[model samples]
Target: MDAGQIVEPPRILARRSGDGWVLYMDGVEPSYVRRLDGAIERGRVLMEAGKVPGVEHGAVLKIDLGDELNQRVKTSTQATADAHKAQVAAAAELRRTAAALNEHGLTGRDIAHVLGVSPQRVSQLLNDQHARG
Candidate 1:
């Protein structure tokens, strides 16, 4: 290899079709990935195993999976963050509701029954509310 010459990372084309991800690399076997993280992991495994055609062992691999796949991953990540935010908000609301119910003369057991949670959980929520205040 000439000095300063650009070495392109071995490219693997990946796409989600139907239920799974399909991957294609030059001179290597076409493979399918089932999970969301499986395509990148598959590429890494191939690169480390010296299976990406002419690419040597430990060569960096480029996943040229198109914009659609990238968008899907980005959207999924955003959705996860959104879900976490919603979960936090819901927990905060539960704490407030539990405290309010306690002030309205509801016992821990009654609040637990109304919220479909254990009495211990209701007590914990009330404690959390008090701690925050």
Candidate 2:
């Protein structure tokens, strides 16, 4: 195969599946196959002449792996999601606690002290409940 055989390189695509992930690329054209076959034939001849170097890690190309990439992408995404869920849970709990305290004869100021929030915030909570009712 001639070096000028392939006009363009194959495009690669990565996609996630239910089980894991898969990668796809353009199928090899006839010219590309002939090109690769030529390379393989060349390699075969080199091997016949004992020209191949000893197998070693240093012989292959090195690249960045999952560990070396932006590890924060996954971690930060999960952390942000967890934080949002916590914030929602805390808000629901606060509403329940405020209602319970109010029913037990605690004033807005007392509820604020117990909850460590401003009394005005307690007033707003109570007012919201009142408005809803």
Candidate 3:
């Protein structure tokens, strides 16, 4: 395959057959996804070899795996958002704790040692807390 050549994406037909999803591609046998791993593996091999043009890498030929895969994507996205929120909340809590410890006569170096952070970080947190107020 030429590196600069543009390959048109292939049209794929996906359907729920009985108990599993099946993907149909031109010039390729219909593959039973979630049933026979070989079909999925074969699709991957064909795409990698460029025998199947226009198929994106790592894509299951754009076959819709129905609700299960859709839900998984949603759940994964939510998890990522939750992780960010948790990190932000933890940073806010740390800043408040640093300020409280400083008010109790703990120096920036003492707070840094107890909090397992650099003295510079301790100073920054304290300054950030003051600015927020």
Best by TM-score: 1
Ranked by lDDT, the better of candidates 1 and 2 is: 1
Writing each residue's lDDT as its tens digit, candidate 2 over 1-133 gives 4755543322323333444333332332211122232333333333334433321111221122256354766688799999999998887678778888999999889999999999999988777666756
The TM-score that candidate 2 achieves is 0.46
Best by lDDT: 3
**On residues 30-131, what C-alpha lDDT tens digit does candidate 1 reach at each position?**
778875566656765766575554354323334545788778978998999999999999999999999999999999999999999999999899999999
* Candidate 1 Cα outliers beyond 4 Å, as residue runs: 1-64
Stretch of 10 with least lDDT, candidate 2: 55-64
Model 3 lDDT at residue 124: 97
Collision pairs in model 1: none
lDDT of 3 by residue, 1-133 (tens): 8898876766555666887767777767776666544555656655556567566644444546578987897899899999999999999999999999999999999999999999999999999999999
Q: What TM-score goes with each of the models?
A: 0.54, 0.46, 0.52
* True-structure Cα RMSD, model 1: 7.4
Better candidate number, 1 or 2, judged by TM-score: 1
lDDT of 3 at 38: 53
